[model samples]
Target: MALKRKKAYESNIEKINGARMTIETQMMAIENANVNLETMGAMRAGAEAMKNIHGSMNIDKVDETMDDIRDQMDIANEISEAISRPVGVGDDLDEDELLNELEELEQEELDAKMLETPSPVVTAPNVPVHVPAARANEVEDDEEAELRALQASMAM
Candidate 1:
């Protein structure tokens, strides 16, 4: 009986994990769809502008297409805005603060992902190295030399 209960619990956990994975995948898809919708809106606007310039445009057709594009753009904007809406309670905070926090969170998440992935070790090019003439000829003035000496003495 105990073993059967354990097995059932494990199965339930697996189901929950699978559901979570599905939700994450769906959210990523939604983000991509939002981007595509915005691109589509821009393309429609460009096409409408071109049609107007060509002077072969049908007023009714243009109006209908613009309206449809506007509706779709609004829907995409709303979805994107909803996705970006803050999860925590902070009604009193200013917009800048909220934006800053969101930026920081995004940076931290990016950093975590970077830490997870191993970067490739790139070797320097095997070309002949040429030392710059300016660097080789550079000399420190008395004041700069004194400052460096002081710094070295202090370090010692």
Candidate 2:
């Protein structure tokens, strides 16, 4: 009886272990399918984006735009070179002759200024003038006579 009971207990334990393993395998399969579904969705979205991008532009248009940019750069470079060159058509200029002409004109102006006549001097009417020593005695005598006459009139 003890042996039979032991065998029955062992059989029940084996059945329980097998059921646990089956449940674990089914969970793993479900997880794998879920991951595959998510990957497919991501791939579909990427394909759509790439298709849209390709539809918008082509290789020929890109090449043409690049060519236009290159041509514009060349034209700009030529214009810059033309602007930097000297303006005259091979004309020679003499620096010494120009300096000599400028010096002569300045000398002529200085000579004209020196030749101008000076203006006359002007004096105020009330200011006194210097007289000779002989004339100064006669002026004093006349001043004394006038003073005496003024005194006689004041007395009357």
Candidate 3:
């Protein structure tokens, strides 16, 4: 009787395990279906956006706008070049004559400055000035004494 009861319990455990495996499989299938539905929804939204964008703009209009922008840029570049060009490039002026004229103008300015009257000078008050004593006589005396002392020391 004990052996029959043990066999029955083993059989029940096996059945329960099989049912758990089936439930897990069904759950995984439901999750996969949900992911598939979300992916389809995102794809549909992207398609609608693309259709709206295409409907708003034509290829010819885009090309014409780009061409106009390019033409404006070229015109701007030409105007810039014209403005930056050096002035007097085609003039026929003599460099020697210009230099002589500049020298004459400078000489005329110097002559005019020299002919102007000088400013009046300011005179100081009369006062007795104190003069410093001469140090040359002291230096001569020191040199003579130093030579005599050095000669005497050397002789000793």
Candidate 4:
């Protein structure tokens, strides 16, 4: 009876060991499948990135846009130079005519100013002098008269 009971316990231990081995093998296969799925997802993402890179760039359009930008920059530079240059800085002019006109205008302004200014009234000086009635007819001749006129002008 003891030998039969020992044999039955040994058989039961073997069955549990076999079941544990089978479960371990199945878990290993599941882990391997998950790793393969992750690898495939990485490869798909890489493929999508490559496709987007190829779609986004065009060599001919890029070159044309660069050339157009360079041409526009040249035009802008020319326009800026044209706008910055001084006007009437290098043309020939008639200086003599301009000076004559300036002088005429100055003379006219001086004449206008002289007309606007106030001047004192002209009157004879209040000098006391008496001449005899008979001698008043005797006028001084040209030489003495001219001398007196010159003296009067100098005194004035």
Global fold similarity of model 3 (TM-score): 0.50
- Stronger candidate by TM-score (2 vs 3): 3
Off by over 4 Å in 1: 53-156
Instruction: Residues 1-156, candidate 3: write the lDDT tens digits.
Output: 999999999898899999989999999999999999999999999999999999878999999999999999999999998888788773577889889999999999999998895878989898857644567678878999999999999999
Q: Per-residue alpha-carbon lDDT of model 1 for 22-122, expressed as tens digits?
A: 99999999999999999999999999899798776688889999999999999999999888878775657899988999999999999999999998999
What residue pairs clash in candidate 4, if any at all? none
> In terms of TM-score, how similar is model 1 to the real structure?
0.30
The TM-score ranking, best first, is 3, 2, 4, 1
Q: In candidate 3, residue 57 scores what lDDT?
A: 86
Candidate 2 lDDT by residue in tens digits, 62-137: 9999999999999999999888878994347687887898999999999888888576798858856666888878
Q: Which consecutive 10 residues in model 1 have the weakest lDDT in total?
A: 134-143
Off by over 4 Å in 4: 58-156
Q: Candidate 4 versus the native: TM-score?
A: 0.36
**What C-alpha lDDT does candidate 4 achieve relative to the native structure?**
0.89
Per-model TM-score versus the true fold: 0.30, 0.46, 0.50, 0.36
**Best candidate per TM-score, number?**
3
Q: Model 3 Cα displacement at 144 (Å)?
A: 99
